[model samples]
Target: MNKINIVLADDELLFLQGLKAILGNEEHINILFDAKDGDHLIQQLRDAKTLPEIVVTDLKMPGLNGVEVTKIIHKEFPNIKVIALTSYFSKPFILNMISIGAVAYLAKNSTPALMIKTIEEVSKKGFHYDEQVMKYVHESITNPKDKKTKSTFDANYFTKREIEVLELICKQHTTADIGEKLFISPRTVEGHRNNLLLKTEAKNVAGLVIYALKNKMVSIENDSL
Candidate 1:
């Protein structure tokens, strides 16, 4: 199998270096580029001959934050997966990043092993969340009420079952696992997943997760609903 290409963007020099060093140790990943901010990230992409499989970015930066960078990345290279690395687990932060097209949300303090696991998982499964984020999520579940409305992103693309499948996918269950959990056959799970990718117009599981996250169809917070 080919190495998974990765681009990393973060404003803090020390943190950036640490992440680079940690991810560098992973034999399965290849660091394609590193950037200090969104502008530099874009410039790096322009300079690169080929796109990477994933872009791990810090949520807060000097110029363009991770959310804006994610939106830009999706607009330009819709195939690349965006993962948000942040210190805060605020609801707004998580929702906004998801809204912009992020496949994974992880706390900055997460272990190196967890980070590596998240990257690998999102690469295959499309989304991953650390325990911290999951805790925040479980704490925030209230009855679904419309507090505010932004321009609704296009969720008309996916069928209800497809959406259901995508959510289960994000929850990090395998096809067989999801089938057992949802009382569906593994073959049916696979079919719904394929249809989910088609309807979401995403090339891979990461893209599908990004679509689900950005459209608010799936929440990073422990969604009991």
Candidate 2:
């Protein structure tokens, strides 16, 4: 199989080196290069012949932040994907990244295994937002403060598997958890999620929850979450 090409950006040189070492050991992920901040990353992108499939960036950087980088890449190089690996976990920051074009969000504490898996998933599926990000999206949209615009949901509109997947997602189940619960593989869960996103007309997993709650497919308490 062809390797997944990637560029990594972070402000701390030591952290970047550590991350580079960790990701470098993964045989499938090729570290095309590293940059200290978004501006440098953008310059690298412009200079490189073959654009990487993804960029792992820290939200806090010296020249430009991850959000700015993600926005620039989204607007200029639509084919390139971004995964934010940062300490900032605020609801607004996470939501802003997703809205602007980040395909994934990983807390700085995310395990290396999860980081690797997220990179692969986003590279293949075009997006991979973890449960934490999804939770914020869910709460923001479902919060009583936001005017809930009701939409008519027809159960008949979805297939049995699709509805099952949607329910698991609304419950904030991780891709692995949903796969285990449904006796499906993670790849299968990804497929179902992609379909749900399209069928529900939702932007991301959080949007799926909004769709579910707005249409009364899920309750506020969200016992599963």
Top of the candidates by lDDT = 2
Taking all chains together, each candidate's TM-score versus the true structure is 0.60, 0.62
lDDT of each: 0.77, 0.81
Error of 1 at 207 (Å): 39
The candidate that achieves the highest TM-score relative to the unseen native structure:
2
Name model 1 segments beyond 4 Å from true.
Answer: 130-225
Residue 170, candidate 1: Cα error in Å is 42
Q: Number of backbone collisions per candidate, in order?
A: 3, 0
- In model 1, the Cα lDDT at residue 222 comes to 80
